[model samples]
Target: MTASPPAHDPEPPARRRGRPPRTESAGTRDRILAAAREEFSARGYEKTSVRGIAKAAGVDSALVHHYFGTKEQVFEAAIEVAFAPALNAPEAVAEGSPDAVGERLTRFVLGIWENPTTRTPLLAIVRSAVNNDTAAAVFRRLVAAQLLRRIAAQLELPDAELRAELAAAQLVGCAMLRYVIKVEPLASADLEQIIARVAPVVQGHLTAP
Candidate 1:
């Protein structure tokens, strides 16, 4: 038998294994997420692609699909990264009186975008939503599923759901105009001034008759 092919030379060290060493799957997932965020932010949701994200992330397109399954899933992940900190706003709002809830909510929401750490992602989401319907749908789902419903649950009003949704729309709209679209005067105005003018309106939507 030809000496059994020289006894296979003990299969050698490199060829002994059937597959490469397993890596930390979570690391790859996180890297994909980071890359997705950058791609989405830079190209917007409509223009971003799995291949582009994978190339930017230094991975295979199959890897992005393996981690997120679909472009929508990737968008959802990016939104989560963008909105994670703001997720705590409902809890903060729950701690205060109904009368003060509007101001508190305003401050909390606006404060997030005012900070550079949070502002970048928030602006990215805003810009993408404005330019792409797919991004807008994702944003709506996020606000409805996380922010609006949670805050509505804390309210004792009859029209809590509608009111909460309206408030969310107002907040998001203001952010779009002031920050994303950069509408003059509103965009250049001080944070405190905008809060003072808009908080009462939001509060009214929530607590008014």
Candidate 2:
């Protein structure tokens, strides 16, 4: 009857051209996160903004908000990505000889900081955490939920949580001084030398008699 009303209206070219490729995809979300990291690294938490992140990412500000919700949420996401490798530290403990778990854990974490790709994002995250309360909260949650608690589980010891925190403090302090503060000797020191010295303290924290 009227050619069945042409079945359906032709899709609008403008709408099709401007539409997001999909509702959400890993690739787009990652790009937003990577851009946010660069922005935070360059500007710090207090100075960085969603519009800047979106611009750096070549997307609308709305897209950044769509993917990450808010600037604090974006920081959390970025921290999560940067620390993803370090989260596997529990495995380093689980797979190693009980006595040597400290070195395994230390080596695993320092190795992440040693890589330029991972370190850049970490620098941004740590700097943000130091300067912003919200960033610090995000960092703490990510560390506690994804890393320290799991390592504690593997210890099977009293005060496992405290042990995990102490071990974390040892490694994290070293990382901050070497990577972020750039203290001369520590910054210039060889990775193995640092690990060799720090690993024992980490071991004591986790498994001292």
Candidate 3:
């Protein structure tokens, strides 16, 4: 009798359960940012938590911390993505006709608020900044350094840095009224009308003798 093939050893018992090693997936960072945007948008910055972001992202809380380090970092990342086109203002100012630079800058910056896609998160970030000193610092740094300073650097003027910041202040203030605060007449004002009124001020700041 062909002895039955030696019985295979019983399958090794399954390894006991334990936490799995953390793996950073390629899209994980992007996923986290998207989730963060939603959380901050829905709850505001102070109310948003890393655990909430992780829950929305379908990842462990530790994974969110691993990728972003802290909630403030996550907020900064979200704002950067939302403001990317505006943050690119330096290039627009750099390439445009000198006379039209202010108009182009005004349009580009306001156009972001005009677009619903970019506006919502911006509202969240601005609202958070208003309430939280830490958030305000992050917002101020990015706008000053990435957007304003770069424009200032390209100018041929005394105190170009201050000039650029003043122009930015006008645009940012307009955004606050027109978009965030939803001031009645300004909120409903015609885009061209608003642009017409604001661009001159910006031009003066940038090109005044």
Candidate 4:
């Protein structure tokens, strides 16, 4: 029978070896994000390049550009992924009664930092921002614009923006101390107890007369 058609046409003539067909991988975007996080965390935004991220992710630099237009965009994506839980501050505050807003807000903020998955990337971002002006600017723009400003707008009180900032300061400072710096007592303190102490401060800032 013609040697069985030469076993499937000699394997299709060994397939021409030019460029491999580009088939999208399900995890490509996520892989890029993960690599971006690691790069930004290690080198800060200014030092982390698209090529660096692509190399880290084992893809071409073009792939990184394909997924994220610029280094700034990648940084923003990393921030969004890391702080997604805390981004719900508006909703957390909005869902609660005025008096309990602080508690809800505190719980929400701490809950994010308390989780191991979110905490690691966030710790890296904070550490990088502490010494990198570029990182700090990116952090400030994303947080102040998307989170603090929006939360402030929800308040009926005077100096709502200021209050929101103060509240953010309180939470951010606490997070820095507990999570980043790893200060004893505070770092290892009970989450509930910490919330009890911090919620009132946040509430005071949110509702000060």
Candidate 5:
């Protein structure tokens, strides 16, 4: 009888697409997130693609999808990192005496834009959000929905959420004009000068009777 054909080790399980070994998985996922941020930063939400992010990360496009699913999800994941500092706004508001809540919040928000390292990605996200509804939704969810809700909860004002949103709008508009649009004296003004001029207005919104 012919010798039975030797088993071929089941073809090594076909290597299972995008399934890095457990130890490698975290690194791989982090790489994809980093790539996603770069891509979204460069291309904006409308133009960025999963394939481009995958190429940047040196992985298959399937792997990006595997980690983050849809392009919007990837955009959301990417901006979450850039917006992380802003996420602390509520805590900053809550920690200070209510008398200076506005200054604390203003300083916190502007401080984020003042730093070159944090400013770049935020500028990208702001541009994306300004131009794209999907990106705007993500921005609102991360900033308005989260930060405003917490500030409102902390302040307990009759119009606390509204006040929080107004405060956010003030800072956001200032940031856009200064950082993203680079408009005139505001952009050129001293960081402390901007903080002093803007903080009282922000405080007024939050603590007005």
Candidate 6:
């Protein structure tokens, strides 16, 4: 049998050299986002460029575009990553009875802002948004698309869209004054106090007839 036709061993699978494949696009996206955040914080949105971000990320400028499209898209992506942990607020709020949703929402949002880790990146975004229309637009789109839309869908009130938008405006305004602008009493006020004071107002906007 021709020496039993020496057993043919299957070729060893190709070994992937270097780092293992990145399974999480979010991780790669987040690296680009962190670099963008630093760049925007340091250079301001107007001065920040894709090429700069690409250089910071150790990737080609084209790769940045491939991942995020335009600069506006990159800014939006950065905002999403920065605020992603909070994106579930609407669903969380909607889970409980309507009457208590606002309190839950308030607590959630305030907790995010009060946490030092989340707060730093958030503050950076807020500062950039205030100084640059591009950043502001990106912020607006993110809120409208992610937060407000989800809230509106869960709300059965008349003009739910308007209500969601109004609630977002109120919350964002409070954040601006308290965190970004650092207005005196609001800035120094304890988190519980702010949540207790603001939750009812937000609740009225969301659930009142």
Among the numbered candidates, top TM-score falls to: 5
How do all models score by TM-score?
0.81, 0.86, 0.84, 0.82, 0.86, 0.77
Better of 1 and 5 by TM-score: 5
- Residue 75 error, candidate 4, Å: 1.3
* Residue ranges of candidate 4 with Cα displaced over 4 Å: 1-26
lDDT of 6 at 87: 92
Best lDDT among the predictions, by candidate number: 2
Candidate 3: misplaced stretches above 4 Å? 1-24
lDDT of 5 by residue, 1-209 (tens): 01111233221221344453665666777888888888888888889898799789887776666668899998888788888888888889889589899899999999998998788778778879989999998888887777789889998879988988898889999988988778998889998898898899999999889
Better of 1 and 3 by lDDT: 3
Candidate 3 yields a Cα-based lDDT of 0.81
How do the residues 22-47 of candidate 4 rate in per-residue lDDT, one tens digit apiece? 34343666787898888877776778
Return the TM-score for candidate 5, rounded to 2 decimals: 0.86
Mind giving the per-residue lDDT tens digits that candidate 1 earns over 107-133? Answer: 899888778778877777877888888
Measured by C-alpha RMSD in angstroms, how accurate is candidate 2?
7.3
Q: Look at candidate 3 and tell me the lDDT of residue 48.
A: 96
lDDT of 6 by residue, 94-174 (tens): 897889988988888888888877876777677778788888888777777888888888987789989877876778888
Off by over 4 Å in 6: 1-20, 23-29, 58-66, 131-133
RMSD, one per candidate, in order: 8.3, 7.3, 10.1, 8.6, 7.2, 10.1
User: What is the clash count of model 1?
Assistant: 0
lDDT (Cα, tens digit) per residue for candidate 3, span 23-115: 434366678788998898888889999889978987666666665778998899898997787877888888968998899899988988899
Deviation from native of the Cα of residue 40 in model 4, angstroms: 2.0
| Cα-based lDDT for every prediction | 0.79, 0.82, 0.81, 0.79, 0.81, 0.75
Model 5 — which ten-residue stretch has the worst lDDT? 1-10
